[model samples]
Target: DVKVTQSSRYLVKRTGEKVFLECVQDMDHENMFWYRQDPGLGLRLIYFSYDVKMKEKGDIPEGYSVSREKKERFSLILESASTNQTSMYLCASSLYSGRRYEQYFGPGTRLTVT
Candidate 1:
């Protein structure tokens, strides 16, 4: 089975503190995405990478960034985190081409910024 592991399941930080959320997938997929989920805003895409060192900004990329140094690992960075940034972070991996290109999501990292 394909597995996605995150560095932390929960995190708490003060406002203005920098945060890093790590994710790794074992499926050797070409596409990786980072999304933040809030109450009413739904799941908003933060960033996505199609290939190593290649990234694209999503709908809500204001205070977020991403890194894809390797094929299996993708990192999400929150520069100067704030209370508004507190939410559940999800990392998903998917193949770029297939009959079903559905994304497989990780367990998610709940971040609370106070």
Candidate 2:
């Protein structure tokens, strides 16, 4: 079975603070993603990395950045946290087959930016 783990289950940070959210996958999947879940907007993609040192901006990447230095690790960086950014952040991993790939998700990190 594939396993994905997030660095924190809950995080509280003040406005303008730099925050780091970490995710790790054991399956060595080729694609990794970061998303933010909100009540109305649902799941919105933040960033994704298809390979080591490669990154792409997702639907919402205005204030976030991502890093994939190693195959097993992916990190999401919030340059400046804001109250509007408070949400449940999810990390997912999947192998990119020709067809639709099944993504395995982590438990998520609930971020509260005050």
Identify the leading candidate in terms of lDDT: 2
Model 1 misplacement above 4 A: none
Error of 1 at 3 (Å): 0.8
lDDT tens per residue, model 2, 1-114: 899999999999999999999999999799999999999888999999999999999999999998899999999999999999999999999998766598999999999999
My TM-score estimates for the predictions, one after another, are 0.96, 0.96
lDDT by residue (tens digit), candidate 1, 11-67: 999999989999999999999999999999889999999999999999999998888
Q: Candidate 2 at residue 68, lDDT?
A: 92
In model 2, which runs have C-alpha deviations exceeding 4 angstroms? 98-100
- Where is the poorest 10-residue window by lDDT in model 2? 94-103
